[model samples]
Target: MSSTLLFFIVLAAMALAYYIGRQRAIGVVGGVSQINRLHSLPSYYGYYAALLVGLPAMLLLLLWVGLQGQILTALTLAELPPEVTADLSEGQLSLLTSDIRNLASGNLMGRDPSPAVEAAAARFQQLQQIATLSLWALTGAVVLAGMAWAWQHTKPSFRARNRVESILMLVMILFSLIAILTTLGIVLSVLFESIRFFQMVPWTEFLFGTRWSPQIALRAEQVGASGAFGAIPLFTGTLLISFIAMLLAVPVGLLSAVYLAEYAPRKVRAWAKPVLEILAGIPTVVYGFFAALTVAPFFRDLGQSVGLDVASESALAAGLVMGIMIVPFVSSLSEDVINAVPQSLRDGSYALGATQSETIRRIIFPAALPGIVGGVLLAVSRAIGETMIVVMAAGLAANLTANPLASVTTVTVQIVTLLTGDQEFDSAKTLAAFALGLTLFVVTLVLNVIALHIVRKYREQYD
Candidate 1:
């Protein structure tokens, strides 16, 4: 249903409750015609009654509808024939339940159904209709009964507003608790998987091993194969790519942001800002292919022409393209933050005869550094977690070398290769992806914490 329609329904119900409550309160007062004799000034009692009736019913309806399909399917299975049940596996049974529900809802078209199945479908349809009707009636009855009870309890000394406020506070706390619990759940799940991976492969071996051969043959007659879970190479690759990307991105991005924020004409900025943001809107996969097809080969030929040995899939190609892709990331955020710095700081520097660049370096940049650093940290996290560009342009070989000309593999690339085209889930190979994930999470977490701390410290200086 549309929100407007739902809201109107609730408003109408509340209005009815308010009118009924006021009339009932006046009746309870008997011969007292004084307006000041009211228990809760009528409106508070109405709000309390509406909240008591509407909130619980709405909650129940939402919960029931959310779980209705699953509960009905479970109930239907209990009523199904034993022979039909035995013939279906768990997955197939779930599919059958879905089909039956579809048939019950009159959504399935053009089927010549057997009498037995049709009868069952008809019975299910009846049950669903009855359940929906009963819920609506129950909601209305409960709302009316709550209104009547609250009206009867109305006394000159009643504290209905305080009661309603307490309930609202409880609801707010519940919402906050749910948000915190969800974040905790995600952290715990990652921790559990990391623990499982560590149990399968020793923490020391996984962390320090240099070779990453994650193959495990399933057959008994398979030839000798080694699987190593060394993460050092992946970490090295991540750093190399991030370093190269930062080299290309930071100077160009920061310069552009400074130009836009400080020196651009108003008319020019109006057009240029959107164009810069549009760069960010382009998909990363497009950049990946661009790096693979155009940049890598161009760099390879360029290196060969200069008598340098550069791999076709070198870190420079991936990093350069990835850097171009991330330029907008730095520029957009930095531009906003630089603009947000108080103009008084710039005016003060100008009063002392400081040039534009000097003012920016001394006052504006320092003031905006927190926001800029946050943007850079976010971009770094993106570069670290990037998978597609590295997968295509960077080679799969886990070279521990940091030379930009040499090919290297990254942590994200290894995780992708490990999980894709899977054989057995229980093997060390699959579990190793979790270990890599945990490592990635921890590294990103530390980077964020340090960035935020530095930003906070710098902010205090300016303030």
Candidate 2:
């Protein structure tokens, strides 16, 4: 049976077990009227039984699915002629295995298989069928045994609720461990690849050198193909665009938030907040198109009219559109933070002869400053990580210039470019993407840490 079908069958079995367990509990308590004699509720008993039946069977299914491919592959390879496998490298063997599997499934294999390969493919198919049947039988047996055991154990004094709660707690802990382990895995993978990249291109050159070209010539004798791994230009461009975005976003978003939270009428605030937040729901690609097609042209024309040179794909266009895109993020969070400031603070300020604007500027703003800063940090991170807008509007020339009207590229754009084509992972060009990813990850992590520290420190002061 297919995994999905087997999953549904297991669920049905669990449902049946739940019904049986609930009725058994009621019977043990001498009917519904005497149900109060039970240690736990009938629902708890049902849940306990369902979990006992489902969890063990699902775990067995998962373990079988995870190991079946390796086992089948090993068995199939054993059926292949020794002469065919003796001289094959790991990569070649993997490709041959793929071809065998494809042939077994009657799919296109890109090339005709030898007789030995065809024989192995047939064996593979037979083994796969056996594995599937065995998995189904074993899973069903496990489900039946677990349900029977749980039903026999269901009694008036059974601690079903405690057992269920303990299982739930373990599941929660397992989920948390999965998240932490996944993060650690990512960090280690990126770190290793980055180390390899640095070995090819010196760390000092990659970190501090000004140029950013990453193309390596296929032949050593190729002309004019010096691959520069300098990342300074990309860093400069990213910061410049992000700074421009923040300049446009911070004032406009914060002012709008303040107006909606404190000054605007109820009806206006109600309608305007949602309308402003709708911008966050719009996809970044749509914003990219707006930046490229609409904003870039308008800026180019205006710069031309003013007798100033503007590139067709300038950082200013991307930054402006990105700032607009991030406005909702800033506004929504800041509004909530501002509104959370105590009304008592405002009254105290008023009693001190402070006007409404003065109260907001001095008292409310300080109290809410931590959250506002956190929101701005989040917006800044959003702007930094944005790829579509940078790729579509800002030209991919990694020019190390401070002029926003000039073309530039970001770290994300370069990473995408480096990894887009079919390239060997061993090459510096491909490894550079991992290096850039690690740097970006570290930068964002630092920003988050700083934001959290500031929020907590100031929150404690206020509270």
Candidate 3:
């Protein structure tokens, strides 16, 4: 509810900002009729003002809302009996806060609500409502203040264009700051949880150990029991499956993309691109079922006929299905990047008596290498993060072997298994999900970086 209100508040502030900015620019230009004489267009001034007044306020609102919930939770906890707070872990505390919020909204269900808890919940609700109202009022007041200040400074002699440009520059800075902050936040969250996981299991074991067992017993007596924390098998399984998927997807997708971008007739390209994209439009879960029910069985029988041991649930089947699922990603993105390569490069190659294939391979693709690698890297990340296909068709056994006929498990599958069903929150099994998530994030990041580097290096050779 507060989020929804904050959105409207920012929108209203933006509207007011646009009006103020436009009025100021009009005054400087002598009137709306003189807009053509101004240093910048009237709309730019409005947009500049809208960005200026709304961005800072929106940032403030976001920061305030983030902190406010935590602050309210702490206060509510402090007011509660010591016994209630004593046994609560961080996860439980979060759950408690959610319950309080539910109770405050008169929607508490399951188990009779305690009187004291109910009272605290009601107060929290009242405080949230009051805070929301106050924030909206304060934001409106600030908008009005800014508008008045701009109006007073607006005159025929005033430099409204310069002011608007300055505001526009600041808005761009804010946007860049937002992107950086978001990336930083994701990395830090992963790093912190990975550190915690490492503390529980030796970093050496996680990095170098070959065995990948992570099951920990539920009781205190189970501490120091035999459970391997090695991640090698999981890593190997991920690599093998991802490799197979990529091998299947890349060549087909790239050729399709090239044909569409460079040679296909207009009607064919138009119909082909969207039809290819429809492959990506299908849900991954649907692909999972296709892998499990159809592809896996078909492969198992085929391998059996060849007198080879093919597991009913094999990485090959999952990888094949996953590859099909990723074809559209590679095709769509590669098409865009291929099309972006200057057509002059192709013309130059053709003038040298090079065939279309030779031109694409030697000139156009090299020029578009960075974007192509970017697309492939993105596809690889999607393959690595894929869960449903591996869960359904790839076996749960964490086999380190790379043979396509054998069963294998991926990191995402393990994470799902570890966290599924009723379980103790602090258990290493539950925390392993966060650890796996952190590892997955790092792998994807590295892939992206390497892809960018490869693309850059390759482009420089030809460009």
Candidate 4:
């Protein structure tokens, strides 16, 4: 059976177990009015039974789903004749196994299959059927066994609540560990791939070199194919665009937030806040279209009218649009932070003969400074990581110029370009994407660390 179908079946069984366990608990207590005599409530007993029926069976299903394909492929490979396998490399063997699976599933394999492959395909189909049947039978048995055990233990004196809570704590810990381990796995994978890339291209050259070409010739004799891996241009472009975005976003967003939070009327704030936040809900691709079609052309024409040279696709256009896109992120968070400032602080400032503007400037803004900074940092990060707006508006020319009217490309755009098609993992070009990713991760992590330090320092002072 499909995993989804099996999951629903397990859910139905757990429901039945819950009902039975609840009834059993009531029976053990002699009457519903006598439920107070039990160590735990009837609902707790039902929860305990449902968790018992679900957790173990779900765990087994997860394990089976994760490992079944590998086991089946290994078994199929072991059954293949030595003549068919002996000459095959690991890559070839993987391809052969894929063909067998495709053929067994009645999908086109793209090539005629050998007699040995046909035999293996039949065996794969048979084994898959048996695996499905066995999984269903075993899961059902486990659910039934768990339910019976839970029901037998559902006595008047049983600590059902404690058992259920303990189980829940363990599940929570398991999920936390899964999240931590998954993050570690991603970091390690990117680090290792980046190491491979650095081995092929020197770390110093990749970091400090000025040229940014990443195309290498396939043949040694080919001309003009020596790739340049200097990443300075990419980093410069990213910072330039992000800086422009923050320049446009921070003052406008923060001032707007201040107005909405401290000065605007209730009705105005209520309607205006949601209307402003609606910008966040629009898709980034739509922003990209606006940047490329409307903003970029307008800027180019305007720059020319003033006798200033401008690229058709320039950083200013992308950054302006990106800043507009991130305004809601900053304004929403900043407004909440501003509103959270103690009313007494504002009152105290006013009692000291300070005007409302002076009160906000000295008291409210400082008190909410930490959260406002955090919001700005988040907006900056969003601007830095944005790919679609940069891709569509800021033409992918890895130019290392500070002029906003010039074209530039970002690290994310280059990473996408590097790994877009059917890429060989071992090639420097593909490995470079991992290097770029790792670098971006490190840069973002550093920014977060700095932001956290600032927040903590201010938070301690304020608290």
Model 1 clash pairs are: 209-230
Q: What is the C-alpha lDDT of each candidate?
A: 0.81, 0.93, 0.82, 0.92
Task: Give the CA lDDT, 0 to 100, for residue 10 in model 2.
Answer: 96
lDDT of 2 at 61: 88
Q: Model 4, 1-463: lDDT tens per residue?
A: 6989999999998999899889999999898999999999899999999999999999999999999999999999999999999988888988998999999999988779999999999999999999999999999999989998997898888999999999999999999999999999999999999999999999999999999999899999988878999999999999999999898889889999999998999999989999999999999999999999999999999999999999999999999999999989989989998888878888888899999999998889989999888778877778878999999999899998999999999999999999898989998988999999999999888777777777777874554
**What TM-score should be assigned to candidate 3?**
0.82
Clash tally, candidates in order: 1, 0, 0, 0
211-256, model 1: which lDDT tens digit per residue?
Answer: 7777776677776656777888899999999999988888888999
lDDT at 149, model 4 = 96
Model 4 residue-pair collision total: 0
Clashing pairs in 3: none
- Please rank every candidate by lDDT, starting with the best: 2, 4, 3, 1
Candidate ranking under TM-score, highest first, comes to 4, 2, 3, 1
Per-model TM values vs. the true structure: 0.78, 0.93, 0.82, 0.94
- Candidate 4 Cα errors over 4 Å, as ranges: 108-115, 460-463
lDDT of 3 by residue, 1-463 (tens): 5677767967987897787778778877778798777766666667666766676677767777778877777777788878776878988888778889888877846878777778789779777887777777776676666666655655554555677678768769988998999999988876776777777888788877898777766577786656787888999999999999999999989989989998999999879888889999898899999999999999989988999899999999999999999999899988898887777788888999999889888888878878888889989999999999999999899998989889999999998998889866566666677788888988888988888887677654544
